[model samples]
Each structure stands twice: as C-alpha cells, then as structure tokens.
Target: MNGSAGAIEGCYWQADRETREVSPALSGDIKVDVAVIGGGFTGLAAAYHLKVADPGLEIAILEAETAGFGASGRNAGFVMTLFGASVSMMKALHGKERVRQAHQYMVSAISALEAMIGEHAIDCDYERTGFLKIATAPAYISLIQDEIELFQSLGIEGFEWLDRDQLAARIRSPVFLGASWEPGCGLLNPVKWLNALRRLACANGARLFEGTRVSEVQRENGRYRLTCDH
Candidate 1:
C-alpha cells in the first residue's frame, strides 16, 4: 500500500451526509446522572440502550478517539456465536444453563445488529450469508463434533458438519478435515455499520465525540465524572 495511497480509509461510524454529526470534542464541565468511559461498542451500546430505556435519564459517553477507532471498527466484522469461548470453558465458569444463556446473548447481539440495520435503513452491505468455521486437521474433528452436540442439546439447530468432499466444493483448502457452518452468521463492513449506528444514535439524542481523549474517570458525590484531555 502506498503511503499517500487512498482517500481516508472508510470507517463504520464516520458522520455521513444523511447522518447528524456527533460533536468531536467535549467542552467545559458538565453534569450527568451517568458518565460512561470509552467510546467503543460497549460504551456506545450502553449509552444508547440507557437512553432508549429511559430518554429522561442523563447519560454521557467519554471517548478517547473517534468512536470507531478502537477494536469495534478495526475488526473484520465476523459477528460469531460459536467462534470464541469453548462450551467446556463456559460450562465450567458459569454452569451449563448460564453458558447457554451467554451463548444466546452473543447470538442476540447479532440479531440486534440486524434489527438496527432494518430500523435505521442503514446501507452498510449487511448480509446473512452465514459464517463457516472449518477444521484444518483430523485431530480437531472431535472438537467440532462436540460443539455441534452442545448446540443441539441446547435446542439450537441448523449447524451443519461438512465432510471433506462438501468442504472442497466451497473452499479449496486441501488440509481442511471438515467444516462447520452456522446459518445465522456472516460478515459486514464494520466501518459502515458503525457510522450508520453513530448517526442513528445521535438522531435519537445520543452525544458522540470524535478526536477526543479521556484522561481520567472518577466518582464524585454519587456521580461519575469523566475528564477529557482535549
């Protein structure tokens, strides 16, 4: 890639023509019932949800950079339900029912994203092509099978285990022992989705700041105070 290669790389949450602009910096001191630190998905999601739950609630978000500058925007946008934590690990940590609920939560987050896309009419190239996790070795086959069984026991369905022949038809990787395809997973442009969300949130009365960094967070007199570095 050339140093001066292209126009600014696209971001999922940069203010767009149709979207109202979020303030890029915080000015003088302000007071709010709740002050959230960090501007990524969790912070923004919390702020948005808080306001949605009760619009009269006072909420503020302190972001260190443009909202999507963190892991939320830099990610490849594969929202996975069966990607990270293993079933055994979760069951050990939170028991089977809680783990299952946790898995459902992750899946629900994806569903929420889809719902937001529809409600806001965000044109972020979102799709539900489904995500495939392929096992690259024979030794890993059992692990894949185990996950399938766990999903089944939880009353989750539509996860298919593809054998070598079936895998070869879609992916040319020769070393893949098999693949597991989950029907409800897929990818999207993270930047587009985020920007659209930022816009929608702002329209619905959420204040977002870009190019601002938070230096410290403190609780004072039963309220959270966020100090920004400007």
Candidate 2:
C-alpha cells in the first residue's frame, strides 16, 4: 500500500470509464411523497421500483456525495447467493425452513436484478461467472463437505461439490483442497451499475439530490423531518 487507503481510488469499477452522471445538490426545502435518504443501490432501487409500480408517485433521493459514492459503489462486484456464512449456519440460526425461504429470496433477488438490467439495457460489465467457496485447509474440507450435505438434505438445487481436481479445472490454485460451487452468482461493475440505476431512476421521474448531507432525522406529526447540510 503505497498511498493511504482513503486516498486510493474507491474501486476499479470506475477505472475503465471515469466520471458518470451526477445530480445537483439540494438548494432549498422541498416536499415529496417519499424522501429516500441515500443515493446508493438500496435508495436508487427503491426509487426506481416505486416509480415503476406507480408512475404518478412522487419520490426523491438525497445524498451527500454522488450516487455511487457510498458502500454500494465500493464493493467487490460479486453478486453471490450466500450471505455472511454457509447454508448450515443459516439453518442453525433460522431453521431449515427459514433458510430455504431466505435462500430462495436471495436467489430471486439476483434474478430480478439481472432482469432489471436486461430490460433497461444497462451496459455495466456483468459476467455470469458463478462463485466458488473454496476450502484452503484440511479442516475447512469437512466444512465444505457438510455444507454440500446440507444442500442435498435440504433439496437445494444449483449447488454442487467439487473435488480438488474439479476445482483445479475451474480455478487453478494449489491451496484449494475442495470447493462448493453455486451457479447463482455473477460478476459486475457495481459503481457502473449504480450509475446506470441512478440514470434509470431519473428517467423514470425520481428526483435525486447530491451533496446534501442529512444530519438528523425526526418524526414530526407522523411525518419525517430531516435536518441536512445543503
């Protein structure tokens, strides 16, 4: 690390094409049916969907920086199905039924996202490269095997186990003893995708404000009042 992490570029997603579109800052007070607090993936997705669901709905997104300046812009572009830990971990905490539901939900989310991108003709680099949860040590091999067993026991499709040779065929790595391969995954440029989503939201009639930092949010008479630095 030659330079400070903060000083380094947020991500390589923006390297190919620097500078996407940016919205203007909030100038004065305004009102809307819905006021979204951030311009990242969650906020932009909400604004986009709300407009699509009800074309007449009024929605606004407020952000202190550009649309993709937050966490959504800086993540490694891997749209994966697993979250936090293995499927067995999910079953332990939330039970087998809940795990099934959650897994289905996440899988559907990826599908919906891909559909959205396709429908909107977003040109963000999206590769259908499924992810592999590889085991680095011998101890982890048993963990991977157990995860595969859980996947089978739960009748979860699209998940399979790969032996060392099979794993090497996909990704040549000396440390990989085995790996769990799931087809429900993809690679993408998150920042580029965010910018495209921002543009799409704007085109769908969602008002976006940039460089407007929200300092406090309060509920006043059943409505939210947001104090900000505009």
Candidate 3:
C-alpha cells in the first residue's frame, strides 16, 4: 500500500523486498494479550507499549503491507505545539497554572520523542528546527499576539512574533500577513520513523508479520480465532 499522505511525496519506510501485492490472510488461531487491528502508529505504539509493559505477554502485529505502509508512514512530521483548546478554554478547564503545566507536557512529549529516537538509535532524521504558524488575516493577529503573551508569561521561550517584513524574510510567501514561530518544532521523514519503530519492535522481541491481513476475528471459547484469506 502507498502510504503517502495527500501532498507528501515518498514512501514511509525502507523496503528490503520487492513490492509483491499480496494480502495473505491469517490462517490459524493465535493468542495474545492485545489483538491490534491496524499497523499504523496506534497499533505499532500499542504493540511497543505492551511489550515494554510486560515482556511475557504475547504481542502480534498483522500488516497488509510492509511495515510503515500506511498513514503512519505518510504524515507531516510536526510535533504540533500545544494548540487544541483556546486560551480561554485552557483557563476554564484547569486554570492558568494547570494550563501552563499542560503546555509543558506537550513540550515534554517532543523531548521524549527525541529521546526515544536517540535511545533506540532509530535513524528517522529528526530535527528541532522549530515550527511556524502563519496567519492569513489581520483578525487573527490578536489571537496570535495573545498566544505570544501566554508563552512569555508562562516562561516559554524561543517563541517570536514575526511582522510583515519578518514573515516575508523568513518565508518567501505573499499570502501570510504575520506568523508565530516556535523553536521547538520541526519535520522528519515519517516513513523512516515508522520503519525505525518497526525495527525497534522486532528487536524488543515483537513479531511483525507483513503482508498478513486478518479477515475475520471471532472469540471462541475464551480464545480468539483469526482467519486469514490471501
């Protein structure tokens, strides 16, 4: 399967074999602590987490294509800054101090991801080149400025507000009216990242079966039976 997202060009991982289109379904019954459905990040993460949580537990990953042959392989590798709820919502949900803590967690996650990459020696080409959020209208400037203030108030550094000239100087784009830059965000080849995770999963004693598709999974007498059709 070609896992490249809409505009991103390139596969998600390296292939050690030819692309023989095959959907060899599971044939026999298997048992495990968790039965993951997809081979994307969620599934892979689950498998990895489970293995780390308990090495004795059986973990299996059934992939229809090679590892990282899904959306996990084709994504804009942006560890997005903590921007989900508005500042108002953050204040409402947990107040200012808690909101700052939550933001810290987001930054922590990025650091954790980098640490994972280094600890496992997963060569996915990760970098902390920072991130830019551009505004297309003057109305958004207020919101952007508010964010900058919040960052400064919370002692979050490396965030800068870019005016028209600054924005133009940083990015040669005529559409943006202004922009917010953070030094904590960057991009990477997701395909390579996924592949590296797969390798780590294998090294950690997790069995990954590529080109294996699970057609039917039914519980029978407290045991799950998986049927594979190729």
Number of the top candidate by lDDT? 2
Query: What ranges in model 1 sit over 4 Å off?
Result: 1-22
Global CA lDDT computed for model 2: 0.83
Candidate 1 accuracy as TM-score: 0.83
Write down the TM-score for model 3: 0.73
| Backbone clashes under 3 angstroms, per model | 7, 0, 5
Q: How do the residues 139-202 of candidate 3 rate in per-residue lDDT, one tens digit apiece? A: 8887898888877887767689989898898787777888899888867767667666766676
lDDT of 2 by residue, 1-230 (tens): 22112111546666656554456778888878899999889999999999999999889899877677788888998998876576777788888888888888889989998998898888888988998989999999998888888877887788788999999998898998999898779999887788888888899999988877898999999998888895
Candidate 3 error regions (>4 Å)? 1-25, 64-66, 83-98, 150-158, 210-230
Error of 2 at 4 (Å): 24
Segments in model 2 whose C-alpha atoms lie over 4 Å from true places: 1-8
Each candidate's lDDT (Cα)?
0.71, 0.83, 0.71
Model 3: per-residue Cα lDDT at residue 172: 73
- lDDT score, residue 46, model 2? 94
Q: Model 1, range 1-230, lDDT digits (tens) per residue?
A: 12221112454344342433445567777777767776677777777778888888777677665666678767777867863468777777777778777778878988998998888788888889787778987778889888888778877676899888988888877788788888788688776766665666566677765555778777778766677875
- When summed lDDT is taken over every stretch of 10 residues in candidate 3, the lowest stretch is 3-12
